[model samples]
Target: MSDTLTTIGFDADDTLWHNERFFALTQSHFAELLADHTDHETLMQRLLEAERRNLPHYGFGIKGFTLSMIETAIEVTDGHAPASVIAEILNAGRDMLSHAVELLPHAAEAVEHLRRQYKVIVITKGDLLDQERKLAQSGLRDLFHGIEIVSAKTPEVYARIFNAYGTGADQGMMVGNAMASDVVPMIAAGGWGVHVPHGLSWEIEHAATPEHKRYHEIPDLAHLPKLIETLTQGQINATS
Candidate 1:
């Protein structure tokens, strides 16, 4: 294992940019479209269920989300949901797909500052085309040394990606808004895991706060550099 950090992996959705909020917006529209078929609360619950059921088949990102919504609509309406409602659902998904990228506060600054010291990479989970489109739109794509859009964020996956991108998981760090996907697995892979909450997250992405030395929570990415530096110093001090 290295004595200090070498690679820094960042989650794209709701970490470096606004993501969940768009999902929230589209979900709201979905509820409205089917307001007569089911109440918002029940509709949302069913939609969540559909997303969980469909995740393995469809994977992550707007396309999967859209299919989940459509599935939910058909379920609530007993396959009687109007063609218009289905059309609106498709439209909402497309709108989500094309929405302009809005970088979270201090995202660019923190990544740029960190990259000067570490091999910074984007290890986000989502559809390849949509994620690549968002990265291109975010204006920060070129700042990264690598990008890995994977199906899931497991310990083995993190270890593999970290090893491929930089040194190894032991000397790498992963930053993101989702504890389940970003923090937990990365820490489990023997690296630092920094939780930068975006205040909005998909329920499926939620995980309990881990009680581990390598796990950390920060209000936002703005604090990432300082936290990394402090951790680096701590590692140096312990080794010395």
Candidate 2:
């Protein structure tokens, strides 16, 4: 793939390590805290609604989620969310912030392999400090050529980052778990988009898959190297 692909970007959260799972667990904790006020299903729906409303204001990360939980708590309980509940919510957010980084299966090896052949980078959207901390603990930091903690991953953002860090998005490839943030936008920016699914996904991140030739999906990160080789050979065949 070196002949056609110059850069490879990986999404740092669920794509590399355990991320959404923790969010799921935290949401569970949130539901429990508000059990007296609302049922689990109803609380989750309301929490999701608050997140949608506040995303533009707070952006993505534990801080935003914590605020959304508090907002939902207030709304569910008729604007009388308890001080102790708020305190526990803050505590849960802190726990999420300080959670240990656990690498996904084959995450390290896949990144190491790709970096040897391409300009491997991390293109993720989250709180900057938390992202930096996670990278520092991930043990895969040095394997990357660059780390991008974007507020959001849009087509323009992908284009700019790829051009600034490598050649351009056209010769770039991005692998991540979020179709909306990672795969679709990169494809829109004229790069190859590879989807690597995780067991848990946030509903807000869902989008209809783009019907594009450059889009591909792998069962796991371990398959990335082989996919690149196949694409590389196909590129050679087409050009020759």
Candidate 3:
């Protein structure tokens, strides 16, 4: 893996920082905003359905999620949702957008450690302006080789990013929290996928772990540097 992997990509949201928690908080607010119309459990289910239905149209991020909340509100309320409730949902989204970037444990340190020997970049999907703002506020931006705010993390997307960096799939690795977005696609692209499970993950991003030779799962970012070293040394042994 040492000789094969020259570029390492990180996922920005839940992988590097506390992102899904804010979304969970906002979802709680959204349920409250619509409580008069339906039960909390029912409303949550509807919101998840709405988000899934809207993913292709809106892609990923707070703006899209806010829109989904609005749509779900209208649907649950039979279009009688008051304008004030919509305003509150928008405010929730604004607050989320303005939320401070809280780096996860050892996120900065892991990136710093990896960058010394490999090309490191952030491959996150979200609103372009909002993603840029988060990256700027993250304070770890300077440690990355580049940032790619993508619409989706598909195999093609991984291929393109690896190619752009002058690396092949076998020569690139993706470290992230979402198996659907970060791990599976990169593995499909023939790259290594390192899954770092976060405390909270959006239901829309969940996928069953696949059995693959190049897939790895770690508890958190702190263990990443050691994992990389192990993989690198293993590759050295195989080639030697």
Per-residue lDDT of candidate 2, residues 1-240 (tens digit)? 234899999999999999998899999999888999989999999999999999999999999999999899999999899999999999999999999999999999999888888999999988889999999999999899998998999999999999988999999999999999999999999999999989999999998888988999999999999999999999899889
Which of candidates 2 and 3 reaches a greater lDDT? 2
lDDT of 2 at 140: 90
Q: Which regions of candidate 1 are displaced past 4 Å?
A: 1-3
TM-score of each: 0.98, 0.98, 0.97
Residue range with the least summed lDDT across 10 consecutive positions in model 2: 1-10
lDDT of 3 at 117: 92
Clashing pairs in 2: none
- The Cα local distance difference test for each model comes to 0.92, 0.93, 0.90
In the range 9-91, model 1's lDDT, one tens digit per residue, is 99999899999999998988898898888899999999999999999999999999999998999999999989999999999
- Superposed model 2: Cα runs more than 4 Å off: 1-3
List candidate 3 stretches off by more than 4 Å: 1-3
